[model samples]
Target: MPRSIDRHELWFGSKLNPRRNSLNLIRLVLALAVLVHHCWPLMGLGGGPEFAGEWLGGWAVAGFFSISGYLITGSRLNNRLGDYLVHRVARIMPAFLTCLLFMVVVIAPLGYLAAKGTLSGYLSTTTTPLNYLFSNMFLKMQYADISGGPYGVPYPGAWNGSLWSLYYEFVCYLIIAALGLFALIRKSPWPITIAFVASVLVQANIEKVSVFLGQNYDFVLLMRLLPFFLGGSVLFLWRHRVGLHWIPGILAILSSLIIMSAFPGWGGPACGALVAYALLWISSWLPSPEFVHRNDISYGVYIYAFPVQQLLAVYGLHHFGLAAYMTLSAGITIGLALASWFFVEQPIMKRVRKGKSDSGAPRNESKSSLPEETNGIEKQGSITATTQVN
Candidate 1:
């Protein structure tokens, strides 16, 4: 028989056991949701599903930020500055760089060969392979194509439109790191609470604020995403007091929908807290397979799916129809994701942990308290979070 629900026993912090949770599964589903959202456009089928004036991928990305905010804040609080940086870098960069290289060496070449019947002059053209790699190596994604190929796709000249958000996610990491430098965030939730409120207000008044900010794209995006991130941060800081009961979770969902319906402009931003709360609540009782708990390939799926979809489009695979196209894309992307986890992400994280262990440095109890399963790259309690589409 299932355990009985007890209102007093449903505090979020207590239910958030690192040993067992559906967060990895939730993240994987979010990453796949992004892939599905892009499938419509990549297949020239118009936008995918939308709710409350936002695309499905937008919601998925918001979920990613919320989860990241909670996990990363915990990570920072429990880790030394240097160890935190190492884990963050190790989790995100290696696979990302490998994906870029794969684009240059494999995907882009195939596109160039298909277009020109040869690989001649492929490296020297505008948006050359080297240019694409170097320009986006830092995560900003200035260049999305290689040698100006990947032509004839629905999203032409963009090998990977999914990478733009990574820069913002990294920026959020830096923001938390900077905040961690202060004793205020460590002792109380006031700092994150104030930041979340300010971000929501800015999002509500983005149009007027854009006038003074000269319509800067980065500023607008940061404002759009920062609230959810801070929402998660605030939740982490207050987890002990926040209950995860089903009644309140349903209320949060309804409240968010009502607010979005009544006030579209700021409703989404204002409901970040509610959204984060609901997500955690759902995760509390969600059942996930043991494989997902042990192996997190969501990050790999995210960074590789875009380019793979573009490559399939370049080959005119969308002509096979959406079902077949999506099937192939998902299969190939999952295979690549598995490879990335085993070859690049997992091994590197293991080495980093090993090095820390070898150094004989004392482990912070908060982090050490996390389940052994979560010690790997992008695991449940790790600060290195996932990314998404633009």
Candidate 2:
């Protein structure tokens, strides 16, 4: 097996989290998956007719949601309602704005030049320079005038098609936060969690029935994402309670998968219920040394990838062949990832977090020191948790 480590304890949602290395690793892998998906077309080799590979790669987005769910759910619950907004803004905006500026200043101009037949094929352009600039400059909620919602791929020639996922992700954050706020008011978590599952089903139904359903899917998969976030809180509360024997946990995981497969289309509750336990197994069973905790580079990959592959395709590297294209693309992407980690992510996040720590002791307190309490979440951060985004 590929070397596995357990950093679930260190993820962003945890109260005393230094960092979320395991989830970051997962994010990094998902970013690579994004790169490959985009790169494949540029390489001129289709993803091929393999169900598992397609499913796996397509599922990477699901993994992204899962990780976000894990981190944010605990974050929403643990923080002071008022301060949650500030933390969310600080955590998201700096990196997001940085990346957005980069796209407009650097990538869009490159796009423009290519569009006007001035620059060579590190990209190909079927759209006008204005459209190219528009897509890269503003995160369009509806691409090319189609109601594919914001999440679906827009007119391909426009820059940064992948950003559409951010739209859904942000939307997911709102749903969770609102649900979370209601939970706080009612003094209960289960109601909102239950509502979330119902919401996903409603979403799927609206899709099947109404042609107006712009975005729809079995978002029940998203519930699993929440576990990563909530599990961190759970770990903080009950780490001593967890034991490291994997057999029962593994069986439970197997059972969940079996249920998912058998139903293929049913209640999302089963998935939601297992999320906490599934992540628990990841944290306890794995060895600590293997769980290399560190600075995050994954966010950079997430922001930069679409433009990278699209640029490569414009270069006509596909004319050379898939293998050569992938190699070159990976090399370029790695360099970008390293640069993003060093310059954009690490410096900014560190500074913001430090500023918060320096501003006197945290006033917002939780019954326990889980994510809900540690950062002193303000209301603004809660609503705009994922909104001040890249």
Candidate 3:
């Protein structure tokens, strides 16, 4: 007598274990894509590079949010609010604060003095202190002020333009935590699902909302990015039922592209959902080598990239050529990012984890736990697909 295996079981069993996937590399690539996209504008090319202009950077950032959505939703589901906050802080703050300080004390001071030709003038600019305080707080306290840099730089006033996304990322985290806490109390996904649908719809209609409200810059950006974040959450909530097959994944992406081309703003949510599905599909079905998991420098890379680009612009490297500027900036950026991982971020995170263990707090499942559907089929030791989204 032969036993019949559940079709879903066979399907997932044939796929790579989620825990062992190369999400770190995926994030790193996305981050680099953003850096490369910026090269077009930063290099004085007169306009955005074909294919890498506004479209690529925004898409990469959206992809980052999608990954964050899935992993952060998983984080909220499996851990206590306090523990989750602790983990999020450990992942984000140390590297972020360090980068912010570098921008304030080193980059800003140097750029200001170089451009303005007087320390007193640089010191008198209130924007300097404001940038430090507000930007470090994720812009909740103050808006970023980019007051100094070489005049020739493409974006002289903006120190770390890439940082704006961090504020949104933090907001998304809060949103997920709020919904997750409510779901815990209610023991239902309906509320969260409804919120997700509403958010997506709002995003789809963002252009109309912008026009009706006279196009507030912050409002428009938030609406544009929110759909992808919500899509990620939806994928997490419905992970068990979502088709992981490549055929469906491909079709969804193509369909979204067609709809987006046809309907632009109205198709926003559909595009976001398809993007999230494609990202998750790649992460789940394709595993990376064990060695690739050892170091996660994506956060460092992301935080450090803009400063490097700005520095390049100050030095007139942008006049050289796009390839030369990108290569030089990326090289230095990667070096700093690796150093941040090895010296700053990794050590702080390790200490934070140890402190939590020493305090004897009830531990959540490892951040990498497999989804509910795969439980018991694989060894309990297998890692979950969710990686560090930040």
Candidate 4:
């Protein structure tokens, strides 16, 4: 048997040392799934197919958050808050900024020039690209309109609609950081648990609360995203006691699906737990490709795919149907993602992480190089807990 499969079997047979599980391939899969999901809407086909009022894109985003919750929490608990924040920024900002710049300088301008057929006209209409840069960079939830597309995309005007989720994910990161700090200060897990429960309760009652406050709110979006994030944090906080058995993991997934089918309103929290555990189990049990372990281009793929899809639509490929659009967009997007990772994201990340680690050497709180796992799996592997990012 291959060494990777052997390692997997050993981890499984021993039922110990589950900390070495890597989710690189899983993350890439989720990112590609998001790309696929966006193809429908970008092709001007309504808002895409939905099951139980939830689309594949929604599920994929939830999966990303659940994984982020677990991995980010693990990151914070194992590193100083400053180091944690630096790593987070390094992982997200480089690719994001690159995308924004590309959109502002290249894609939007070309689209406008294509429509207007004049340099002066394109230059005159610069507000949209500038707004896209500033707002998205700040995570302000404001999107830029790529004006003057000849035929335009179905979701015309909006440059990159997929980016809105980054804002919420950052908010979750802050919450985890605060809770991690409090837990460290108090030397207890109660504070984290209490905060998690409070967030869940607030999310559950968000609609009523929004009414009382006289404000419109996206209750479904709020409820769907936050719980999974919190669930991942909780799982990491209690990892020592949590069992990684397959039977229970399978049961939890089945039960969550059944509950979601029966009771829509209250089913979210259960689904959050189910998704988090399922993701964790898969990452832990499966043997990922060596290339996945070495090169994490999922973030690049995610941050680039939407804009590429939109560009394809702007060029009049929206009529090429879903299969053609998806295949071509994914092909171009993956190529761009590779460049983003190798040239921008990975280099910036390596520098920032190295600098932070060196500067915080005296105060480094992480034990050894890897997270201490109770399950006894020797995880001197390429992917460490701290290295698993969104």
Query: Candidate 1 residues 1-390, lDDT tens each?
Result: 012335544542225445455777888899999998999999888898988788889889998888787777777876777877777887788889999999899989998888888999998999989888888999988987789878888888888888889899889988998899999888998989999999999999998998898999999998888888888888777765665666788899999889977886678878888888787767666777777766788888898898899889988998999889888999999999989988988788777777877899656432322212222122232123221100
Per-residue CA lDDT of candidate 2, range 1-390, in tens? 113433542231221122211434556677777776766543545553222223444446655554455455555665545455566665555555566556555665554455454554223433433344455443432332111111112224444656666655665656656756664523544455555555445434544544444343424333433333333333322322333235545765777667556644332233443444454345432333332234356667777776666566655555566667667777776777678767766666555455655876353332221121222222210211211111
TM-scores, all models, native as reference = 0.90, 0.67, 0.83, 0.85
Best candidate per TM-score, number? 1
Residue-level lDDT of model 3, residues 230-345, one tens digit each, is 77777666665565566666787788677766766556455666777777656655555554455777778888898888877876777888888889989989988988888888
lDDT order of candidates, top first: 1, 4, 3, 2
What candidate 2 gets wrong by more than 4 Å, as runs, is 1-21, 42-44, 47-54, 111-116, 119-156, 183-187, 208-245, 263-280, 283-292, 361-390
lDDT of 4 by residue, 1-390 (tens): 012335554444313233344556677898998999898878878777665556778778888888777777777776677777877777777778888898778777777766566556554454555655676677656655644432356877776778878878887878777877765623655556665676667666777767765665444455558887877776666655565556666787787678767756546554665677777666656766666655667877888888888878878876877888889999998899889978987778667646756765533332221111112232332122333222
Model 2 per-residue lDDT at 180:
62
Candidate 4: residue 158 lDDT (0-100) = 70
Error at 350, model 4, angstroms: 0.9
Give the Cα lDDT of each candidate: 0.78, 0.47, 0.66, 0.67
Please tell me which model should have the higher lDDT, number 2 or number 4. Answer: 4
Residue 364 shift from truth in candidate 1, angstroms: 3.6
Output the lDDT of residue 235, model 4: 66
